[model samples]
Target: MNLKDFKAKLKNKIWRNVKAYFYDQRIADSTLVQNINLSTAQNQKKAIVSYVTYSHFNDWENNNIGRTQPFEILSMVKVLTELNYAIDIVGCHDLKTLDYLKLKNYDLIFGFGETFYQLTMLHPNAKSILYMTEHHPNFTKIEEQKRLDYFYDRKKKKANTVRTGNFYWDHHMKKKYTHVITMSETEPFNTEYTKPFNIFPTGILNNNFKLKPKNHDSSKKHFLWFGSYGAIHKGLDLLFDVFQKHDDIVLHVAGFYKDDRQLLEFPNKKNIIDYEYIDIQSNQFLEIIETCTYCILPSCSEGFSTAITTTMRHGLIPIVMENTGFNRLNELAFFLNDFNIEYIDKQLKEYSTKDSEYLASLSEKVFSFANSNFSIHAFESKFNVILNQILKND
Candidate 1:
């Protein structure tokens, strides 16, 4: 056999073996997730919240982060009921960390979190909104390193090493479900069984967050580079070196990170400020991001990130790598040739010189775009229609 074919076969075999190991270990956890779901599904048709960890006040307890979604789900359930639709949440299998409610009555199930696989057996009679939040590499012949990075061996795809069970089960359910929703990902499983799958705007902190005023020097400029570290495929290494060389402009960070070797790495600069996290919906959050003149997302892979949406909403000139998720953003944003700080500095300085019209235009284009397609009202309305379909079919 050719070397390439041999390599590909070897990778898949290794992946299969790892998946098998996790399958055996996670069976108990999956059962617990299932048992909880079965209990929640004991009733007839009623409106349900099909998402996960609505009660997690922090980013950790919940796999997904941003603004509150459970409340949004609750509100949507109300809207469904007004339209005479029955709703019940198939909260997947997170009864332990999930906020339990008296949801004995509902029409179908919704898959919002990590626990969806368990509901597959119990909720076949129910409809589901399959919202997957994990990043996976799709090719059976993925590189050895990529597979290891995605945690396929442990059944967990990156992030926490906990609860690796049901990777294959999740895939089967992901394909079988009538309705599926996902953000961008490293690996996407677009199969005939998933034809009904659609992409939707990520839900953010409900009406609790408003545009608070955040005035910056506007004259001076700062740049941002961000993403979750565990998913470094987001491309920080690609950009960091060039950023260090300039030492003139400021670099702001968001998402999770920790670097003590930082002192040794770029001991020369006083411009980099690591806030660790600025809660996306907090008033403080808007102000800090506003202080910067640019938003940088060096992502290798993505689903249309809400961060990008947020940057545009506030008029930060997003400097993103071309042909990535930032493809359509050319009209409203700028591009960098690479992670070269020289290129980044040139673009930032040129854009920073523009008057309010430029910023206004940037903000206007994004505001108009967001209103047209990504407004919360739009997300709720779209999901509501999908729910109706699930009801008809279920």
Candidate 2:
């Protein structure tokens, strides 16, 4: 093995150990081994909800794109707590297929993305809330060509896995829940299609998105993208080319991938700053966004990027690509760009936060836009509306 690879491997091992040592599980140990039969408590004005996430604890902070479904659950839990209900969370399925958790006593589950679909089969009596990201056979059809692909530049990866063989994807045995939860009136998700879908986003602690006073070299502007880079939808390869021709500009990356990918080694760019492996979907990620100059996501596909909303919260000017379920791309998106380098470069020169005047213009509007539409209170109000309605009938 190469020396660099060996050293990086060592660093990864050390970092993993460090995180395990310090990352607080925040879970009460008393709740761990007890037999939790939520079904028995079924109608007690309390709920025992189960969440089946697309990701888990290891990836929750180990990589740059890492997020915590637990934190999201906790936010909803806090809301439900105020409403006088209790909830429990466990991995959707354990390593062994036979060990899946299924009991018919829970009230509702707000499961995310692909994991929600499979987990629904486990609890037929419980409400199955499918909160999914954009994917094939769901949002954009294969016929929408020339459009960018979110999974590693390949159109095939973004295709409907639900329709593929042995995928055995089905929803017949399981019935759709009365409520489907999602955020915004955007792409990859259409409230029209999934009626009674509630728009509930995670609430942000203001300090996390509060900006600190710092010196700015208004002349040396930066463009930003904060999300996972494992796939091409993040437009990293496109940035490699953009950096080649522009020596004055810089790129700030955060959200996923610990090390710079081999494809992002731009020769001419002054600097490439990376904030890898911060627990975003967790509560910590908001702090990172507040500290950033501005955040951008040129994703080829998205239902609604968590980073995009978080960035906007902290007054980071965002640049976005128009794609699946990205419909609410209103004032939140300041400088939108196509994936091609030439058009991007031209826009960057004109619109980037390169001067005090330009920064001032954007700064004035940033926080207000986020507060009005992206606050936790707003999320709770909408979500509770649905919960109240459901309970009224039940």
Candidate 3:
């Protein structure tokens, strides 16, 4: 391998190990920061953000190249800091009971997890803002169970629920918050909130790779499935069943699937190319974008699906499930009405048969839509507006 490829692999390996440690250990007592570089005015406001804490210690410049959470956490901190709040950040998995004596002085509580829940309950005078990055827990549980049942009916074996919400009771649907900020559409699924409900645009990394001309004649029959974990919940199984029957179509799979070995060993796996855990900045991702005309995801639930938007930024037409928080795409995307094998098979076949010029036009539209709505700048701008409104209303 070349030095660049070797470095990328090494960085991924190290990041995996770090994430595994955090997930496995669940370091609840560890604080990311006490008072993050703020002036210690006696009457200054204080806020606690319960989200990904490890982002503070990692390579900030490279955080955007993989998962969107690190960049998101850092951006939240920036906004809160500019609002004249001294912030403290904690990991979402920190579920240990918090000390009430020390935390009672905070003026605002943000983000999700046990930390947010405890603070919101203890400090009645503080403004509690729930930062929702997924669907409501009730909606997520029901949809995930339905997907699991469908998988069992097909395979005659039960699969683990991989994409369900972690804390159901901490959401705005179950409890009261001063304001709720979400990254997904929350109309019918999460209408329980009486406070101000704000939806922010999901962000995508700006890759440095040059865009290459796509061969739509060849790519019209090629499809890409890009997601992180939750292979079944994201409807990769449906893709496997459909693509296995049609040998002419090519499906390029990216992202790390927990069931990678089992899912990749399907009946006719020749047409399915698996590039596990792809970095968005890598040439491998660029090659996949050049070869694929469509990016398909039938996830049960999502918060704008950064994976889909990331693929769209590279000129791939999105084929996503309807009402899974991507309704904003309107006509810019092809919405799958059903997740069954027959329905998906029909849709993929019909989409593949479109003329090369028509498919290219759709690709350009998707690229433009994603570029306009899902950039990092868009996320920061929308969030700043939402935060200002929340503060001004108080």
Candidate 4:
């Protein structure tokens, strides 16, 4: 390995070891085990699960992309608790804990993302469920592409792309789990799970995002590409190119772009406004949302775009590509044919000419849709129904 790459690997190894050591200590706490197992005496069903942590639920700190894990987990816990179910939380990071717990004995096993598949598989008789975060296979392809690009740029010999397949890649995991649940709007790509795949939409705090007076002039209407990290993977590269070509439509770019210097090349000139990394809860966030008629996210893949939904809650319509994983993009928003720059440009141009009255009507439609679909009430109702279904089928 090259000196730079070797140093990077060594640094990562040290960091991982450090984090692992602290996590081991945290899980070792005696009170931690008892607290999760606590339940009402009348409660009948007791579930044992692992991997999901309180830190996952803390949205403000994690800066979660969408479907705040804490809210989703807490909502599930609330439903289970109300049903008189005792939940024993287990930390999946430590193999010792898994061995000690005997996961199969629990009435239900709750797991999130791919790793839990193996845990569930180990306990064949365990009544388990997997709550997948995204369309994993598609996401993997993107990661693979990025790795290959890095290798190519470095002029490395025999640039081999490594495919690190996770639980999402394994179709058999479908049969392994009792049933699969996802935050995604549609069925994941290349899936063999014939059983019930429940689609539970994510919840958004109603008070956090409210409709504000927007600039009514259609001619001056701009778009905001609110994203985080993974700029290239999120298709910000394509967005930058597209925005540079179109002077008529102002595209305001927001969010943290890590290691992607291409954004620096496209100065905040022409019709582009680069407001890098503003707090979503800040007044500045609302101000930018108010100025824009549409929130553009031509993402390559997503389990669900929280940015799109959050913006819609503030009454900005969605302009997205097909595979954004948000199924509700039908009549309420505009869909790009592909992630091509030309297609995005064409779509933006078409949207730019839309009159003020039409934009106002569209905004109302989007707002109503967001309120009905993305609210906490809607989330709870759907969650309760799914919980009932899971129990009934079990």
Candidate 5:
């Protein structure tokens, strides 16, 4: 083996040993691990097993971090149970539990990304489906990583680790899975069966999120950039550069920075306000959306953007890139062809010049699109259609 590979293996071995030593104690205290158990009561349909945390099923408990719990995982389990199928759910991290379960008995298996590998082990006959969340190498990985490296000041080692993990999962680990469900047509999923589920993943937004009769005076010329970490990945640096130059539109940032130094790097531009780390459940998060006319996210890549959908539900027009996982955003929102300051500046200027009536109309369209596309009802209906097909498949 090469010296680099040897060193990596050695480091991983040490890390694994440390993890194994604390595994039992940590597992005992983990809510996700504790909830990983076989379903009670037998049903009529073929047994179905899936890899998903039990906490994801609880709407109240969902933190909406990384847009992970787009829909309740248990909702799918409950549907299978209602259809008289026996269900078994295990935490995605509980690899050892696979040894205890009768893997061959399951007629169907559903999992996300790499979990499909473990789900398919010793069960070649079972139908398997992978929920595609990101595009892998040779598709958009090079471009995506290049953008991230340029924009985000993350450590090289950390970036390499993520790139390697994603590459291995999407390329090698996912090969055995036959089916894939994706949020966008452009996202590449190398599998025998691929289905494009176009709607962006829905979050906690409900009918209440629609800010009715939005006060045009206050909301006009206000924009928001809200997302979790990976500041460079989401193009926060590009945003800072543009927003600093143009004082016409007020930009509010609602996200956690990877480092305090990243925040300190940006000087106090008058038009920019930073409310670091706004919780989705908090009034501050809602108020930002209620008062903002547009939400901007020039992300390098995304499976689906929860922030964009959440903002849209609150009647905020989106200004994002094509690869941000919302296809045909030009219909109801501004689509950024490039993150260059010159192009963004020109677009911002155009938006600044738009009349309130036109902006209000766009806001209505945004709200309509979000409500129809990202609602729980929409997810449930679409999920049922897909699940029904899978259950009946030969």
Candidate 6:
């Protein structure tokens, strides 16, 4: 490794270990019934959001580094407070056991986790909302396995499946909810829940990125694959297979990969550039944004990828797999109807051959669409409407 890359990796490792130590210490001292109350009045209606409370515990304003969950969680609390409801926040994964007696008096239970499931069962009279951030667990499990099997068939080696559902299988089994809110298409949830589902667009960090002029003729041959974790599940392996064979096409990869060996297996391909982990706010990401014309991900499942949306906001025309919760974006994106190596290779080559004018126009459309639909303001407004409907039982 080069000196610069080696220093960055070492810095990241040290920071991660330090952060984990403090995080674990905080968890050890945390209490079961402790909550962050946001009530304007004493007699306001009470609601409990069983999601990430770490947003409240940290200096989120300054240390906003990864994912949109922290902002989304804070937005949910803000909406609940504005609705005249006293809100209590809990970390979904932090609790080993919940105090049922202490929580039974809450008028509403929202978000997803084992605690959400337990509360839904314990208080049948409460307004329970299941916030699904992914495809139904069954769908996710089956699809991830399918990708793993496909990888094994091609490579003659096994890789770990990293995209397994966070919520247990039994969380949805035979459970009824007052309303179901999702960030993706609702069709996948049909197999798991009979309840009505409401959809909201996932939010992206608007870095206020300004689009710059580019030579689409040159950039069109360059593609980007940006994601976090679950490299195989996000179809990075498939991308490696396609780009490595065709030196004419360049694939720029960003994001964390847990399986280093999976990366080592396909090393030293001149056509592929790996920028391991990237911050969207960094100059490295901006340089990549300027270099690539298309952002591609063939992920097996998603609840609307913010990764894709973020790239779209930066004027990268999206080329994504069909039915991976991107059906809503079909008009703005190029959809791959199949996931096989032959199909991907055929489609990508066809896409890269488009004229510069055509590529630029499509990129503008994608950027405008993403800015209109996937902003934090858009997410908050849509979520507010959904929450009101649930509260009023409309």
The Cα local distance difference test for each model comes to 0.51, 0.51, 0.77, 0.64, 0.65, 0.78
- Residues 358-385, candidate 1, lDDT per residue (tens digit)? 6655655665665555555766777677
Best by lDDT: 6
Top candidate by TM-score: 6
Give the per-residue lDDT of model 6 (tens digit) for 1-394. 9999999899999988887768766753433333345444566677888877666655656674567776777778878878877666766654555653454477898888777887777777888888878766667788889888998899887777677757644555458787788776788567656755655454454374688788998999999998877888898888988887898989998884656445435457888998888888777888898999999999998888888878888999888878778888867889987789999999999988988998888888888888887777777887898888777752
* lDDT tens readout by residue for model 2, 60-165: 4444433424455545566666555545554333323224334324555544423344455555565555544333233333413333343236323342221121
TM-score of model 5 relative to the true fold?
0.78
lDDT for model 1, on a 0 to 1 scale?
0.51
Candidate 4, which segments miss by more than 4 Å at Cα? 1-43, 55-67, 90-96, 136-175, 188-191, 200-209, 218-220, 261-270
Question: Which residues of candidate 3, in runs, are more than 4 Å off?
Answer: 1-30, 61-65, 100-103, 170-172, 194-203, 260-264
Off by over 4 Å in 1: 1-50, 53-68, 83-86, 90-107, 112-114, 134-174, 185-190, 193-220, 226-233, 258-268, 279-287, 321-330, 333-360, 371-373, 389-394
Q: Residue 231: error of model 6 in Å?
A: 1.1
Misplaced by over 4 Å in model 5 are 1-51, 56-71, 102-104, 136-140, 152-170, 173-176, 186-199, 206-210, 215-218, 258-264, 328-330
Q: After superposition, how far is residue 39 of candidate 4 from its true place, in Å?
A: 4.5
lDDT of 3 by residue, 1-394 (tens): 9999999899999988888667645533345566874686556798888786776766565444466776777777888888888888876656553652354478898888777777777788899888878877767788889888998899887788767756545353567787778776767534556654556455454457555667898998899989877888888888888998988998888874656446435444789887878878777788788888988899998877888878888888889988877887898889998888898999998999888888777777877777777776777777888888889965
* Span of 10 residues, lowest total lDDT, candidate 3: 24-33
Q: TM-scores of the models, in the given order?
A: 0.60, 0.65, 0.86, 0.77, 0.78, 0.87
Q: Counting only residues 3 or more apart in sequence or on different chains, how many pairs clash (N, Cα, C under 3 Å) in candidate 5?
A: 0
Per-residue alpha-carbon lDDT of model 4 for 273-306, expressed as tens digits? 7787877667788778768888888766666677
Deviation from native of the Cα of residue 220 in model 5, angstroms: 3.5
Candidates' RMSD to native: 12.8, 10.4, 9.2, 7.9, 7.2, 9.2
